[model samples]
Target: MRLTIERGALLKALGHVQNVVERRNTIPILSNVLIEAHDGSVTFAATDLDIEIIDGAEADVERAGAITVPAHLLYEIVRKLPDGAQVRLDLSSDDPRVTVTAGRGRFNLPVLAAGDFPAMSSGTFDTRFSLERSALARLIDRTRFAISTEETRYYLNGVYLHSATGDSGLALRAVATDGHRLALADHPQPEGTTPVSGVIIPRKTVQELRRLLEDAGEEVEIAVSEAKIQFSFGRTTLTSKLIDGTFPDYTRVIPKGNSRVMTVRNDEFSRAVDRVATMAAERSRSIKLTVGDSKVVLAVNSPETGAATEEVEADYKSETIEIGFNAKYLLDISSQIGTGEARFEFADAASPTLVRDGNDPNALFVLMPLRV
Candidate 1:
């Protein structure tokens, strides 16, 4: 393959696809990227068997052909080249190496047959939909922090995405939990969206997709089946295998009759918790919340680190209640509350507590209290 492309354009495409290639691989071809030049553009594809990413850039094609080369090495070489430099790639049928030329620098990289690269087959999609980029970003940011990292509960290691009925009617929801904390966020269902069964999008796939969305256009196309899911950005596409397991019914854990309510300034509450948590034990990181008539006291006591306390003004009229919660979990949920005020509903010190944004009714969080 012989083609010429701008250094910035080539580097951007490489940056997108090379991340999917594992640093170490048992199969030689799995460590390489498949590069193809044809139809006035060049495409770079890389995969780690479970996930595949393909990105393309416009280029000057001298001759149409394809080849495979070390993904990271090529990326580094092109990245170090001068900005706006023209990069030329040349490969001959009989040669076992591909020559890369930029400015006065030239390098030869070992090549592999393009046919040896594996491709993740995209089966027929049972449901296809389109979502505004901002909408999808909101759903991921609000819930992904709660995704479980425990390996045994494989099903909980991803966000549960499905259709459900919300206060506004039909909605698309994303829910994630790690047993200690749960986060749920919803967006109004898009027009012409086909109802789909709940699917577990693995953590790694969610992270990669999030990175791609940062530079994606206004709209994104999504296709889903029982086995795989695909996201198509303008000049880039990502295909990933869905986790093969059933997520537990999350509704069972959400409390239904918590009537006690406390409304506090989110910024004030977060800062207070952070200050008191400095004295919390390393293992438990537990902080106690003493809610009273119109104020809340945040305290942390550790045998090794001593004790710390802070009082934050709040709007609460219920019976005084003292609850214990992980300081990190509290801060994480608090960050997702978009409004200035954060509302918390509690049943008792021993029961799960419900938290919500004062302004955004579409998002909610549940925190399991710890024994302080």
Candidate 2:
């Protein structure tokens, strides 16, 4: 196999696919990337059994063939090469190694048979849809923070994506929770999308997909089946397996009868919580909020550290209420509120509190109170 590709183009393709390859692999071929050079283009593919990524770039092909090489090693070599230099990869039929040449630098890397690289087979998709990049990004950004990392309750380790009936009509929703907090976001369902059963996209897949979307075009094509999901972005494609466990009914945890409401500027509230949290205990990181009239006071007390208090103006007319919460959880939810006002509904200090973004009615958050 022989091909010449621009340094920048080759680096971009390698950077996208190499991340899916794990640093340590029990199987030899799993640690390498499969490179296929044909016609006028070259494709790079890498996988770790559960998730696979493929990226392609145009190249000047002298002899068309396929080979596999160390993914990270090849990526670093191309990344450090001169910016505009042309890179040539050559592998003769009798040679067992591939030679990389750029300018005066030459390096030989061992090769593995391309046929040994496992390809993730995507079975027939039951649902297919298209979503604008911005819309899909919004759904992910607002809810991913709450995805649980606990392995025992594997169902909560990913974002639950499905179709639901919203205030306006049919909506595509993303929900994630870690028991202490939950985040839910919605977007209008695309016109021709078929209804699909809810799917739990694993955490790693969600993260890799988010990174790919950063450079994606205006629209992304999505295909979903019972056991797998695929996202196609022009020359790149990502296929991942769906988690098998069933996610709990999240609606039961979202409080519905909270009567007390307090509205405060998100930025101001976030800053106040951050300041008082410095004195909180390392394990709990608990902060208490005293709300009444048109103001709220945040306080943190730790036996080993110290105590701190800060007051912020708010819009509230209900009876006085005191609630305790984890300072980090509060900040995570506040950041998602953007620069708008944060509305909090309380039903005393023992029940869960509902939070919403004033500027975006499609997003919601629920936080469980701690015993202060």
Candidate 3:
């Protein structure tokens, strides 16, 4: 394989695919990226058995062939090259080395045969849909923070994506929960698409999909099946296996009878939580919230450390209520409220609290109170 590609173009393409290759791999080919030079373009593909990314960039191809080389090494070489410099790559089957030349610098990287790379099988997709990039971005951003990091409850380790009847008729919903808290967001279902089956998109793939959609154009194409999911946009494609566990029924967790409503400035509440949390113990990090008529107090106490209290103006008119929660969870859900104001509904000190942006039907969060 021989090709001449702009340093910026090559670096950008490598940036998309190389991260999928693990630094330490038991299989030799899994650590390398398959580079193919074809008619007027070059493609880079890398996979870690579960997830695969393929990126194509325009290049001047001198010879049509393919080679697999160290993904990180090639990325570093192109990244360090002077801006606007042209990079040339040459590799032949006889010599198991790839020659990379930019300006006056040269480097030879060991290569593996492209035929050794494992192919990812993306089975037939039962649901296909396309939506605005911003819509999906909002859904991911609103719920991804709530994904559980625990491996034992593998079902909670990813964002649950499915179709639901939301405030806006049929909607595409994403929900994630870590037992302690939950986040749910929805977008209007796109036209000309079949309803999507409930699937758990693993955290890693959710992260990669977020990165891929960073500077994406107007729309993104998605294909989903029981076992796999694929995202295609521009000149790149990402295929990932869906987590094979069933997500718990999240609807039952959301409280519908929490009538006591409290509204507060989003930034003010977040800042108060952060300040009071400093005095909390590293283990619990529990903060207590006291809601009184038109006022809210946030306080935290740790035996090893001191105590902190902050008073924030709120619009609470119900009976006095006291609730304890992890400061991190409060801040996370509050930060997702794009509106300046956030509304919280409480059933009692022990029942889960419901939170949402004032009058925004697109997203909601629930936090299970802690005993202080």
Candidate 3 Cα errors over 4 Å, as ranges? none
Better of 1 and 2 by lDDT: 2
Please provide TM-scores, in order, for all candidate models, with all chains considered together: 0.98, 0.98, 0.98
Cα RMSD (Å) per model? 1.1, 0.9, 0.9
Model 3, range 240-358, lDDT digits (tens) per residue?
99999989999999999999999999988898899889999999889999999999999887889999999999999999999999998998998898548999999999999999987
- lDDT of all the models against the reference? 0.94, 0.95, 0.92
Which prediction has more favorable lDDT, 1 or 3? Answer: 1
Off by over 4 Å in 2: none
Clashing pairs in 2: none
Candidate with the greatest lDDT versus the true structure: 2
Q: For candidate 3, give the lDDT of residue 305.
A: 98
Steric clash pairs (candidate 3): none
lDDT of 1 at 205: 91
Candidate 1 stretches with Cα past 4 Å from truth are none
**Residue 262 of candidate 2: its Cα lDDT?**
99
RMSD of 2: 0.9
**CA displacement after TM-score superposition, residue 175 of candidate 2 (Å):** 0.5
